[model samples]
Target chain A: MPTPTSSEASGPLAVETVGLTRAYDTLIAVADVNISIPKGSVFGLLGPNGAGKTTTIKMLTTLLHPSQGQARVAGFDVVRQAAQVRQYIGYVPQMLSADADLSGYENLLIFSKLYRIPAGERQQRIEETLSFMGLSEVARTLVRHYSGGMIRRLEIAQSLLHHPQVLFLDEPPWVLTRRLAMPSRNTCGPCGSAGGLRSFSPPITWRRPRSCVRLWLSCIKAGW
Target chain B: MGQTLAVAEAEVRKLRHDPVELLTRAIQPTLWLLVFGQVMSQLRGISSDGVSYRDFLAPGILAQSVMFIAIFYGISVIWERDSGVLYKYMVSPAPRWALVVGKALGSEVRSLTQASVIWILSALIGVHLRLELGAILGMLVLALLGSAIFVTLSLIIACLVKTRERFMGIGQLLTMPLFFASNAIYPISLMPAWLRVVAHINPLTYLVDGLRTLMLTGGSSAFGLGLDFAVLGLSTLLLVVIAARLYPTILT
Candidate 1:
């Protein structure tokens, strides 16, 4: 594995991309993008559909390799040190990620092991996550039986199990609305929603972490 | 290592939630033993190496059952992709190889279930089986290796096709040829010269040959038992690496 760059050790940015680009044949999905997301602050990439919002997220999350240029997440280069980048971040994609055949508890337990969470903390954390996500009532129930809202909450709970430092949400406003509607007691706060990209939705200011939120509402709504 | 087992444990856990799926899957093999094996045994022209044709067919059916279960595993990967489980797994810290191994291990569990069902049915139908500790262990090892190979092959195909429809089409096309090309239903000696050569190279041949030798009371295989293990072991190692290499392409 390659060592981290010198600036990465003391860098102020949690995520940084310089001249990052991705292309398919002649279509440039993401092009020459340069942005810096500071640590501990909420940052949102606002653009219309196909404005490369999801593509940007994919590159940053190490799910899609950049066709050209560089990106670093948590001081590790996305292309060179994808495994290291994976260790520091949690991603909730546009789609639901849990296995419907398994129960809510089983989904979280599997992720706990995948993330190599210590065996001692696994059960405790799973229980806590279930309660936090409001999934405790249906913990043992198959995820296939879970309503759409419950499935999203379970996904959020699974992502947060390892306590990642930087969390990425692709098109989360719909879920965010539901999440915003969640009782304040169990919701992960706005500040924890770092490195997010909101596209084409009405921008609403959050009362909590008011200074931390950055909204991008730049264009007329386009198809995603 | 822990991650690999975790991946496998997830699959096994799914089985626990729907045990009926296992029982349902056994119906095909059970019918084969109760109907086809008995009907085929009446043909005296096909030599059975001194054991009853039912006994000869038992191990062949076992290999075929395992192959069918494993070859369709790629379809699950396609489902996982659509449902978001594959994406979740991709971003994890676990090595890609662990994910592949875990899926294969899970398939092994399913294969073993099918094997047990076949074994019990064979005993009930009066097929002469050894039932010794060594024979049972040998059958188990062959089951695991056979399942691992087919499961890895399924993953490779999933990576190449990237869609449920395409994967299913390819899976259906491949399973029949792979089954018939090998000695799963009959001995290679009965095959034409051209297919006999293909059977020599087919991995399934080794599995059936090994199972028939260990499973039957007085069975002898043209290929030795050690060669079966060697071929299956080598093929499994190579397929695992290939599957791991192809895993990342699944998202693209």
Candidate 2:
């Protein structure tokens, strides 16, 4: 119930971490670290496997509390103001996040409901998101039948449905740029300009022939 | 409550796309009625108090089947974790309690479907049932409550174990004791002193007692309707709360 105090309500940073740390028993999974990402820009956390990139994203998204240190997402404290943080962030983890059992539209609908999208706007938002992700064609197709890249797009669409301020994809494929380029249409471009989203994911870049938002890249190695 | 229902609705929708799964799951309960019920009915020593043994065992089998479905539900939770679906839910704005309750509510839908099948099978097998509106409604409530309790318990197990092997082992260990200790198959009078104590504490006992009373014409509850509901309801609420608290730990 703690509301984000001070600049958190309307800060320039989409994400910031100071001495952020997460440690397991006798092993530090994510050590003391600091990071800052400004609004309206993309920041990618780049590292090899076990570099704690997913763990860091998890902590910032309020899915995993930090073992020690301070972290904030979209101006809200990840731990003390996690509910507020969740409202402002969309997260796609490293693994396949889409529910394969349901159709693509059904998966988005469920996310829409979970995100508490306004009932009146839910349909419109879903359509826009599906189109944005180029999933409109297979909207009714079972997700299980979709290819891995299609599933990833649907998962991205799910995160974007809420129009989160900070969109985090833990480990999107490097070819995501090509995937997002399928449509010459401006998809994430509008959100970037509207102050609705900041992309955060290493190995993920969205490039359309017409427009692109540049990214700042960071790294964590061996739990550092 | 809306978020809770949304979580539950997602589950129901998944099954809705494949209704055959529900019917397929009913096969076990059908076997229980057609095979075990008939085979056990002829026993002379088991006291049924006048209502036929098949009729007595029908509710027990239904409750057992519900337990069987719910107790191993942790495996799915683990699967969701492995598949990364749990991450989507964990990071959602919905509270942990709502997510747990929502999953439990979905299990109720599954349990009720099986209950309907058991009702039809019981009738065909010549078990005289109450079939009255009030009784049917009561049975529905009992099944839902029972399913919620068991599924929530399953969720807690999922949180603690967080692995399929451990969860399956624990689930298998639980179902047998939960079944034998309950007054599902026989009167509580038949249990040993210690097991009678365990039966008194088992939520499954209350479910079977309520189901037996509501499903059959001559069926009666040893603990009375009020007590049966109170036990199941309170236990369910408690388990749901516990499971919700534990839900986040699975991620850790």
Candidate 3:
């Protein structure tokens, strides 16, 4: 793991983990992991199939509580200030998180409301997000009828509807086409080479897309 | 309140894609009212004075139908968990109880379709319902309140059981006991000694009590309307809290 020196990436930390660990009853899925992602930096956690990438994201996103150690996102403790963390971070899970029963626009609108975007700005924000993700044409289509890639884009649109400070993606471009992955740049590309919105992408070896940016790779081995 | 309404708005929007579900839900209530009520109303000792068995059973079937609609709300929660829609909600700024109640409120709106179906059917069959605007409005409150309790209870079950298969089995396990043990089918007076105790403690009893008083002209609450509302209202609040706490367990 390449833990950057202070001079390498200097800014308020978008994400920081220290001795982070998660354990099932008898097995530790993620053990004593530590990484500090400075705001405006794009990074990925590379690992194998059973390498605990999903569990780590789940903990950082406040979806699951870590068994040991502590981590924070957007300057808030993932556990103690989880609500605040949620306020500042946008997360798109690997699974099909978009509601199949709803149209793409409705999904984004619901998320916009949940994020408490002002009512006046919601329509334009959702429209802009749909267009930004290349989903404007099919905005009225039910997610149930969408192709895998379209569904993935809608999910991405839902997360970015809030303009969060940091975006945490479960496994972007995992099983997705090339064009499907770049919008994260629009949302995450706040910083040029030095800094911007921080994104945590842990691409599994089998599913990593060819176009993945290789700015920095912190590889976690199996059972990590 | 804004966040809670938003979560509910999302869930409610799904019904637009499948409005037929509301019509289908009305089927069971139809059977209970037309078939079961007709047969049971003939029995000598079932209904109290001045109330025919059909009129007596109208509100009960309405309560039962709404209960049936909401009691399995856990299944959808399990689906949300699997599809990762739940993860989005979980990680949102919305409060957990708000999520639970918002979801309950959404499904409760769908249950009203069944409630209205039963109401229309009750009027058609000449059950002599209290059709005044106020009574019907009051029924709306009771129906939503009744279904909200079941929805929150279902969410609690979803949080505990987690998986779809187990949730289905437990959902089935709960609906019958919750239905039969409550005053939805028969009055508390007709229940045996042990079940009478269960009926008193059952939140559905209060719902039925309130629904019965409001739905029928001559009907009155076995337990006063105040007690009925107090019990169901408090129970919904309690279940919301419990479901919210157990909600994170779904991720495991």
Candidate 4:
């Protein structure tokens, strides 16, 4: 295995995978993937739909065994010291994996207890998690009734409940559109003001107004 | 310890939301008790040491229910793997033992509930319990110990198998053989000479015999009790070690 670079060695690394690979029979889902994520950094894994990002994340999180090489999360080996590695990280899968039959509060409480948050702190932690996720009112409601966004938010909340040093989020941005849209609106508001207004009007008028309308139609056809 | 409790708590919470699944879990066993027991009682030439067919069938069906419940241990693990919940648990701070224990305990608790329901129905159908309190306690202990072994075996299978369809296919294929090969439905002597040898080797045969001895014989023989307990204890420990070693490989 290659040694960590000086910069990497100096910084606190949250996750590190060296030559990680996963194969199913003949097909390789994840090829040699080596990445170092810094502590507390909100890293985004960008790739096309099937670029093996989920597979890579699965190996790093100790969910799937690597066919080759090794990984460390929060300084613990993913293979040799998996239980220790699990101690410092939280994982939110791409799909909603919470028990649909369980109440939101019950789900949080179960995970909090599983993580071994002390008995004295469990009630407070569960309440705080529910409040943080904006699920306090409906905490008693079954998760099957929760909307997709609510389920996603609750899942994120569950990951944070353990106060993990590292969090593996498979598709955080797609589920966090509200947060992503805020910064972009502020930065690009002035530059696209005229175009935005013109684009907005065509939808209301339901009329194609030549060049700009063609662009709107094309974008719509692509299903952006 | 905490992780096991958490997973068990989560499973319990799931039950609260979908109590029907709990009912569904009991349904198959109940059918065996009600329909199959009645049908088997009428079957010719199925006698066990002068006991009525219902008496013999009760313990067999009980063991069978316990076995069926244990098989879900692997099925649930595969479901978690496919659906990604296993990943969540794998990366959590929960100890591996906690995960294994929690799942096993959860299944045990579910099976016990089903067992209790069946026991009540058995009582209603005139299945008598002649044993004193000591035998009742022995029966409970044996059921719990036997469940641990079966659950561990289920986990080993689950950790080794990746796909749901394959797991189910193999699980179903093994269920009847494991049941029949044991001294569950008929006494070991009644089985074919070869099958009698196979039944003697089956860990489940000891469990069923232990349960029957406690329930029917009323815990009279110290030697029988000791041998039964020893067999069950040893098997539980061996299967658990195998499960623990295999678990990390699967999760990794």
Candidate 5:
């Protein structure tokens, strides 16, 4: 029930959900939730399974309608201005949304076309995205052949295809551990010979408006 | 529009990754045509018109194929919702209508592919094709519009249900009834009075009737074509509006 603070009012908020509530019959999935996410930031909606993180993200992104209240993304109302809102955000859902029958590059091409990236620039963008995710080599391979980690990476790459102004990461607690367990751990060069080094990289990095980050960090630390 | 297209493109690409799935989706209808159509022909009194059973069965199978292809349209949405891809679409800047349109169009594209293959196979099996450019174009339009209606129906169902089991259960419950209730399996005149009423109301009946006219009669009757087009067009418009309205609400 936290309101958007004065500091967050200074810039364009990437996502704002006020009094958002979703109910099915008598079951309340997400109730009276309020949040504000700033532009250009990676916003993590973290909670236990079925904690309404996914539902909340859906409302903010215009996937699900709120039973009460409103959600706006990138300065557009998710309900009233949904098309404009969708044009500005990138969404990567908890499950693998990519077509397993398609090759990596083919998948990217489809998204490029959907996002209406200029026809002229689509090829370059596809190539760049594939390479960025280290998927260029496997670009021709069917996604079904992709490893679990590779699938997640490809999902991330697809979300960034259009360079969405706000990114929502609905990280279920279990998936977080698995994603963090990947070999993103880098050792200091000087300590390489010592066969050990502290894990310098945080398990996850969320980038959002400075004020929202502070509030988000505090919430995470509080174990909400 | 752009983002919806992107999601659709992704959906199409995913199809390539699973060749077996694509093969099954494409080949199942052909098998039905080859086996079921041939078997059903052996039954006495199956044909009301002078048309041979194979000829009579061809357009019906085509309509069925369109229905089958579209039935899975929302399967992707359900899978995406479970996998968080629906969440991605929800959060992205793409318009809700684009998402609906893109998914519908994507399903139409797949349906068209399967329908074309069936058309080719029918020709090989000696089922006559009118091959008039106008007829072919008309068939494609009908198929696309019909596919869009079915796909939208699937999306609405997907949005309403949360689990895959429930989605599949509801989908199965709806599809076959829809097929049987229509003129897809038999002519409306042959159906019982009560069932005939259902077929008259079933949108698929108009689609099948239109396709049959195009394939068999070489062109639809002016009245028949007008009724078919009007029903399909009106249904598509209503479904699109319902889908657009339900889309954002469902996300929450």
Candidate 6:
């Protein structure tokens, strides 16, 4: 266990993983991969389905523990300092994480409580997040009534409620486009053009050309 | 503590959206109390302990209602997992136990509502109750403890099975046996020797026994309210620890 120095604390690296490997019995999902994401940089991971992109996201987000090796997110080791890592990082998984039964506002409010946001600040912050995600119009509407893109935006909004330093987006371009476009357009600096926006998507390959369709679109439309 | 409440509040918000489900849940216990208790109360053989059959059945029905409400809670975990809500909680800064406890607290709230319904139903059906504040509060506490125990058990099953089908199958399999095998439908003394052994070991037996003692008569019954509550409290505490420990395995 290495102690992080003051300089490393303020370093440009938002995420760094060295020799990070996750094996499920005989199969190694992510094998000895190393990558460093600089702060304030928007980096995309391109891999085919089952190519360990989600696995990498899981490890970095502290949702899945790495089998062997070292990984740090937001200056904290994901394995040893998972709570601290969670505090500084946000994750929007491939699937919709917000409760469908809850209104978009309720979902964000619940997350605010889980993150222990101050009572005085919670309502204002939730309003700000909803507005930032362009969801204020339907904040009171149940998430089940939300559109696919709206649900994705609500999830991203909830993750940003606590204002984490690093954000991990696991999925293809539509979510990525929303992730990149909405915040930059509305809030001006949160998850959009701001620091620590990492997106994961399936790789671009001739064998499976359809998977990267959104990838190309996001890069073109969102200007990523 | 705030995290626990947050998790519980989330569940409450969901429940609030589906308030009709709670009413639908009341139908089962309503049938048991109104129909089953009425029919069974007339039978002399089942009331050999000198207590009216309705009185005996009232507490049992309360316990059964809580069991029915809680024993299926695991299916929600699978739903949450599939819907990605569980993953969100897992990645949060909240401790795993806080999440589990929050879930249990959520179930506790449901069970509390169920208890109130049962109490009113029992009174309407002419089943005598202590009706005292202490008795009501005691029963509420026991209902919460009982609910926590079964909800934790459900969570354990959810963690182990990881799918709605298996969880529902196992949950259905466990609930009936747990209900009939316990003193919920019958006194342990009326059971055969083998069943008496099982009933003594079953946590529901303790819950039912506690409810019976607290609701039917003023003081303790043959099963001893002290022992009943002790077993339930200890078992709930133990299961909470086990459930929290098993909770993370569901993600893998």
Local distance difference test scores for all models: 0.83, 0.81, 0.79, 0.69, 0.69, 0.79
Query: What's model 1's lDDT at B68?
Result: 96
Task: Give model 4's docking category.
Answer: acceptable
Number of backbone collisions per candidate = 0, 0, 4, 1, 46, 2
The candidate 5 chain B region of ten consecutive residues with least summed lDDT is: B214-223
Instruction: For candidate 1, give the docking quality class from DockQ.
Output: medium
Candidate 5 lDDT, B69-140, residue by residue in tens: 797677777776665456555555456688788788777768888788888888888887788899889889
lDDT of 1 by residue, B1-252 (tens): 999999999999999988998999999999999998889889998777677788888999999999999999988998898877899899999999999999999888999999999999899999889879999999999999999999999999999999999999999999998889988777777889999998899899999999999999888987899999999999999999999999988988
Q: On a 0 to 100 scale, what is the lDDT of residue A18 in model 2?
A: 95
User: Which residues of candidate 5, in runs, are more than 4 Å off?
Assistant: A1-85, A91-99, A129-132, A172-224, B1-7, B26-36, B39-44, B217-223, B248-252
* Candidate 3 off by > 4 Å: A1-11, A174-177, A180-224
Q: What is the lDDT of residue B202 in candidate 6?
A: 91
Between 3 and 4, whose lDDT is larger? 3
Residue B2, model 6: Cα distance from true site in angstroms: 0.7
User: How many pairs of residues collide in model 6?
Assistant: 2
Off by over 4 Å in 4: A1-11, A16-34, A65-70, A179-224, B34-44, B217-223, B248-252
Per-residue lDDT for A30-117 in model 6, tens only? 9998988766555666555678888888888888889999998777898989998887767777787889999999998888888888
Screening candidate 4 with a backbone cut-off below 3 angstroms (N, C-alpha, C), the clashing residue pairs are: A65-B252
lDDT of 1 by residue, A61-119 (tens): 89899999999877779999999889767788778888999999999999999998889
Q: In angstroms, how far off is A126's CA in candidate 5?
A: 4.2
- In candidate 4, how many Å is residue B249 off? 5.0
* lDDT (Cα) of model 1: 0.83
By DockQ, the candidates rank as 1, 2, 3, 6, 5, 4
TM-score of chain A of each: 0.79, 0.79, 0.77, 0.73, 0.73, 0.77
lDDT of 3 by residue, A14-76 (tens): 788999999999999999999988665566676778789989988988988999999977678
Instruction: List clashing residue pairs in candidate 6.
Output: A40-A195, A47-A203
